[model samples]
Target: MNTQPLDDAGGPTAGELGEHAVIEAIVAAAPSSSNGDDAAVLTHAAPNSQVVATTDMLVEGRHFRRDWSTPEEVGKKAIVQNFADIEAMGARAVAALLAVSVPAETPVSFFERLAAGIESRVAEYSAELVGGDVVSGDQLVISVTAIGSLGGNLPSLRLDRARVGQRVVAHGKIGWSAAGMALLERFGRENVPEDLTEVVAAHCAPYLTPGRGVVARATGATSMTDSSDGLVVDLTTIAARSGVSVDLFAEAIAPGPELVRAGEVLGVDPWQWVLTGGEDHTLVATTANDVPSGFREIGRVGKQSGDPAVTVDGAAPHYHGGWVSF
Candidate 1:
């Protein structure tokens, strides 16, 4: 059994210090007992139902900006958002592995805090780090692969099931992060509020957690997913996947005062923020009439035809949903 840290033995810290070198470093950090094995071996259980799995990545300067977020916050955000994905499938996150790529000149302090931040949420969610890799790269990028169990139930996959006459609902609030981003644009990192600013941070430093919204699941839901993309796109995904049309109410939007102020400052419509603004990672779901206890009955999912597609108040959306990569 050869036990060593990631930086040694020709890993990131001692390697040629390139992108591949960094990836090798982070990969080497995974604690594989097998000296020459490529993957890990986990304890298996007799097949009863099924295990749901998902993988996601967060890159600096693209997915996140270090100039706006602390390494610790970045670490937690990476873990929580992925966990949110697992929860959207109505599952419980159990463990995760992380791979980090940083410049060779990067201080060890950043790594220390980064690991601490990730570990804090992993522990908070009762997940273990298991193993990971560290390497040198052009910029800091964090890649995480999380594993979860379906709590003795079948995973509620995105493409699993869909039917007409389902109700569309979202847990938690909306437009907060969009409002937060507006604050950042206006305040220039100066006038950030104690509460509202976090939405921006949550967008950048998102804690798409699980425990906060679990109470709504056990009762019932037709289908569900995280609002990572925005209300329109996310609901569109549900409608498109479930093969149904979704209708929403614009005035039904319960805008918080923060978004109102954000709209005022940005000279935009707050209603637009609720429908289109994404990155909040709030829970959005469809139910067959019997909505969950904690979940709000927002709109109904049905056949989309004639006139407006995904109407709010029986009319088409005035604005498109959120931003995009391309």
Candidate 2:
């Protein structure tokens, strides 16, 4: 009953282990804590004193379209996503461990720019790129794992306490990037504006500076999660985990002119891109007190015994749903 799961040294990839089985193995091996999850649990019963860790990945073609994105964009996207995960837990990502696989003929400047991009993101987030591995592969892929620390506050979870009617606000522009994607897809790169094109750049190059995560904690948030998957997915995660509900207004999702422009160019409904697009990497959190400036109120959370649904102007969120790997 005490057989330690051997670490994968050279053969049999780590993912070959069943996810649930891997989780159980990790929990079994970890220095015990009451919190059954991997993010982090208190070491001593004092609470608010501990270390935290999270790992996340960004796959090629799925997370980014190489035809459209640059190497630096790829690097920044990889780092920021993991950092956002640490942020969602109400912690600061102090360091990054990155792994990148690129083709043999890839340019040397490509790697320098990629490293520069990582350094830029680290500098942006006040995080350091501590270590990583580089290998040759058929396609470009980048994965980053971040270790963070709780600086005095209790680690925030998507599952946590909240009063009914707490305000849910996110710190970043909700749908601009998705609009940018639509613009590029519909207008073939030349038609989009420099302003909106920057949004496209942001979609590729996510900007989650170190201090933004603290802003989530400072706002009296009861629960928090990053918008890596999408706005509704993570909002729904917090709601489901905390047994609450949220009301989101589309108009309040930030006045995205790029959305309008993209919709116009493609003859597609702009709301679909706004409501369901993925990879914005914003922080959707619940707060009881006043929402800070630049933080837009998109929804509210309350007790509801059903699907962790989001309401659009008091109705459920509806769209075809966005990007799926499987």
Instruction: Tell me the whole-model lDDT of each prediction, alpha carbons only.
Output: 0.65, 0.65
TM-scores of the candidates in the order shown: 0.80, 0.79
lDDT of 1 at 325: 80
Lowest-lDDT window of 10 residues in candidate 1?
A: 1-10
User: Over the stretch 30-145, how does candidate 1's per-residue lDDT look in tens digits?
Assistant: 22342234555554643564565677788766666555556677777778778778778777777677777776755555555566777778777776666666666787778988
Model 2 deviation from native, Cα RMSD in Å: 11.1
Score candidate 2 by lDDT. 0.65
> Which segments of model 2 are wrong by more than 4 Å?
1-49, 187-195, 305-308
lDDT of 2 by residue, 252-281 (tens): 874467667657766877777667777777
Colliding residue pairs in candidate 2: 125-210
At residue 33, what lDDT does model 1 achieve? 40
Candidate 1 wrong stretches, greater than 4 Å: 1-49, 153-155, 193-195, 208-217, 306-308
